[model samples]
Target chain A: MSTPKMNATGEKSPQTRAPLPSQVVKEDEPILVAAAKAGDISAFETLVSRYERKIFRLAQNITQNREDAEDVMQEAFLKAYEHLSGFQGNSRFYTWLVRIAVNQALMKLRKRRPNQVSIDEDVNTGNDLIPREIEDWGPSPEERYKQSELAGILNSTIADLDPPFRIVFQLRDIEELSTEETAEALGLSVPAVKSRLLRARLKLRQKLDRYFRRSENQ
Target chain B: MNCKTLVVELEDYLDEELDSELRTSIEVHLAKCKNCKLIVDTTKKTIQIFCNSEPAPLSEDTRHRLHDALVKKLGRPRA
Candidate 1:
């Protein structure tokens, strides 16, 4: 894997990073967690390395700032390693780690946006959830763009969403968290999570329509 | 299921949380409604596209900084 050179002290999130290898032997997370708890520093480092990219992405999507995301990622890993003893293994280590990262990301987001990203929270009345423009994207609409272009489009579209909707979508769809888990992580009700996720999907679909409408010639 | 009802139930239906009877109703409406079908298809694609995309890797300097901080705060990692 060739490294991209840029910045000092440093910060780097490239516009293009190759997709992770499709086939790499992955160790069981529980075993790694057990080893780490037993004072195996290498095992903990392995866990950090395994999840660093995903956690950073989650933070960046939530915070929409590279520098804050980097800080949040570092804090999340440090916090996870600190609290490793209390993890209890009731959930997947990754899930536990994700919860930590989500908390850190949300704090960064709230500090930056100030009352825009709410947990107590903003209410959407569900009155006008119906989408107006419902046009076929044809088959495999996302294939129309190169991966880097598509990534840029995805990040921008998601960034445009309200924080409530964006955070719900990130947890549910991107992070693959369960409804109960998402609600618990964000301190929202299960129904609220579902409704927010629905809005997020619809909002994102509408946003992407212009780019993927089969006639954009993009 | 009219369009409004379909939208109300879309999340549960997509997540397969709805009972089969309601699912059948939504599917029937989707079969007859072109717009609803497109909305559902595109929404599903939106989820897929986001889920499939990979996160960009951290720069070497940042990774090293994180590890260094961890080492200094806790202790050095075994080689």
Candidate 2:
């Protein structure tokens, strides 16, 4: 396998860049942030380019619609730009920016579905535990073949999750954000983030189990 | 640990959030219980697959449009 090349900053070169595992970049974001706060538009643009795709994907996952995601992306960057000075840098720039994007996405969702209940509200009080008979299917030939199809299945299953669970899964599992960061982004407690993440993962596993089992039968 | 007990602690176990003693106990149980082991292993694989999948990039047109709009609002400054 060809070794992945790195840029001068030791980040994966943009040309061959895969989805970033974490939002953190080692480059001098604080300098760019300072410049942007002082009206350096180019500085702000650099930051935008670095994170726009990530922000867009996060929006897409939450909204479950590309168009709304685009709108949210645009609104998020603009909102962040306008509020540059207010950014205290207490958190990573991407984290702060994500908070803005998530809010925009959630706002759009609310408008589109006015009767929609808050994700925190109306969660079933009962245990509603998942069935325990999860199949192993360890290292089968079908597992190798199923890799390609997994993406589609994963997307559909995730989309089927309730907004609260879906958002947590997107941020925590897909984006690989820390539980604390996920909680901060969604304005939930750390325990809440963990609970949602656990449920989301369990649900996805169940879905995958069923999908693989059916595929094997077929 | 029994299956019910294991089920309650499974997420934490997989996430390595449990205390070392609890983790050891769970591991010991997993070694003996094929069903519970399967659940843990599969759940781990499910998370791994999801995380490893490459996220689709934003369309080029969308990228340019977003950049241009931002540039228009916040005029381009010299690097």
Candidate 3:
């Protein structure tokens, strides 16, 4: 990856960047989509080959079960095939397909589990002239890099978060999705996504720092 | 605000989704309060790490089974 170049807001800008290749889909995408819509089996197979892996992974993440994920993926593809004519290309095919997969995965999850977490915590905005202080909850950058591998620390900490927090964490934090996008995907308000994301991050950070501290002593 | 009240609103502050007045207040307090500063810093880093994570891949067996089921359901010839 190229070093990030900052803009006026100090957020990274693309212009001060290396010329990376664009990630536009291959030129054949529209052709294949059209043919698939017309019952061209080969074209449909190509689309399946292209998107199956992504759809499967999304299902797996949501369901967190191999068998359930497999079922959801298969069902999503079949549903897409039947409704291919209705595929208006409003969004990328994969985005639409993933939505179907998410719905199916959540359906299966809801069926097997009757319990949903209660989100009773009121979003408290403090009376301070300035908002409440926000602090870092995780390890220092140096400690993070020096401790057990980042991957291991992340996995254990993520698993330790509350269930709803874990789900939001997985979808937004891990997925690198924007707040609005995550909110739309999960049917939550933007405020709700922000709240869960903060809580999830704080919990994980605490867990990671504690884990590394213990390991360092041992 | 005291630490108790600040802690409760910490979520909105981190997101920068709070109103301007609240945002400034929080920033001011964070600059002075070492404890709260540590929490915010750690929280931001934790999320950055989590969001930057590479997604795990599906196992080969699961992939194979999914493909087979799709082909059977569609009855399409293998490419």
Give the Å shift of residue B22 in candidate 2.
1.3
lDDT by residue for model 3 (A105-202), tens: 77877776657533323433224322233333334453545334765666556656665667676655544344665667678777677667666666
Looking at model 1 chain A, which ten-residue stretch has the lowest summed lDDT?
Answer: A9-18
Which window of ten consecutive residues has the lowest lDDT sum in model 2 chain A? A1-10
Residue-level lDDT tens digits of model 1 in A97-215: 88999899888888888856686486774678777767778878878898889989999999998888888999877776678888889998888888889989888988999999976
What TM-score would you give candidate 1 relative to the actual structure? 0.89
Give me the runs in candidate 1 sitting further than 4 Å from their true place: A1-27, B77-79
Winner on lDDT between 2 and 3 is 2
Q: What is the lDDT of candidate 1?
A: 0.80
Separately for all candidates shown, the number of backbone clashes (residues 3 or more apart, or on different chains) is 0, 0, 19
Model 1 Cα displacement at B3 (Å)?
0.5
lDDT tens per residue, model 3, B35-79? 777666666666555544444556788767766876786786447
- Between candidates 1 and 3, which one is better according to lDDT? 1
State how far residue A194 of model 3 sits from its true place (Å): 3.3
TM-score of each: 0.89, 0.81, 0.65
Which candidate comes out best when scored by DockQ?
Answer: 1
Q: What range of 10 consecutive residues in model 1 chain B has the weakest lDDT sum?
A: B70-79
